[model samples]
Target: MTAYAVAHLRPAARLDDEVFEYMERIQSTFAPYGGAFLVHGTTPEVLEGQWPGGLVVIGFPTLHDARDWYESKAYQEIAPLRTRHLAGDVILVDGVAPGYDASLTAARMREAQEA
Candidate 1:
């Protein structure tokens, strides 16, 4: 199943020089894990309640890939920079896979009618 990491951030102070450098270096981390940024610092058109500041949505081929990227030592080292600079919510979400109608409700209903 495809997975996404949704980050809704309210910006605080800018990252320190060291942290910024670390951020720049981490780009190499994604390719190995089959992860890529879908949306990075793109301003959203808020149609609902109080809009959180910065939002980033990263995509991964699978939930495992996303987890690996998050848990990896490379990311863990710089994770604090992200937390210190932005404050809000970040979460992983699993998506439905292809051809997932396992219930076969229509077939069940048709058989019941015939019976």
Candidate 2:
């Protein structure tokens, strides 16, 4: 299954040299794990609620690849560059398979609740 690294980054007061450096070096860390940016800190169109900041999404070949990329030394080294300057949330999640249905999830949830 495909996996994703999703980040919701709050607005930075300023983009310092460190942040720029992190941006410059981030792509290098991805190639080893087959990670690619699906969305690179892009401002989203607000259809419903107000969006606090930009969204970043990286797609990986699988959940293991996503985990490996996040835990890899290269990424760890540059993570602080952004962490120190930005406040946000990052999570890795697996994408649903082809022909997935919400009804299947609903059935599972119903069974769990009954249990």
Candidate 3:
């Protein structure tokens, strides 16, 4: 299953040098752990409630891969930068692959639980 890391980030009270530095350092670390950016820019149109920040979505091959990257030392080293300057909700999601069916997914989950 494909896993995605989705974050909704609100910029700090003010952007500073530290924030920019963090951005440079953090983005560099993703590729090493099999992470690729699906969305890494501003949202031009607001479809719903007022969200006054940015959204980032990173794609990973599996949930494990996404977890590994987030927990990795490299990410840890720079994690504070973003947290210090932004606030957001981050989530890991497992996606259905091609030809996926609800019953098949349920069965797979059952098999894993049984094991």
What is candidate 3's TM-score against the reference? 0.79
Candidate order by lDDT, decreasing, is 2, 3, 1
At residue 3, what lDDT does model 3 achieve? 91
For candidate 1, what is the TM-score? 0.75
**Candidate achieving the largest lDDT:** 2
TM-score of each: 0.75, 0.93, 0.79
Off by over 4 Å in 3: 101-115
- Model 3 / residue 21 / CA error / Å: 1.2
Q: Would you give me the overall lDDT of model 2?
A: 0.93
lDDT of 1 by residue, 12-100 (tens): 56556755665586667666888888898688989988786878888999999999998998888878866665578989899777886
Total backbone clashes of candidate 1, pairs 3 or more residues apart or in separate chains: 0
Model 1 regions more than 4 Å off: 13-19, 99-115
Error of 3 at 1 (Å): 1.8
Clash number for each model: 0, 0, 0
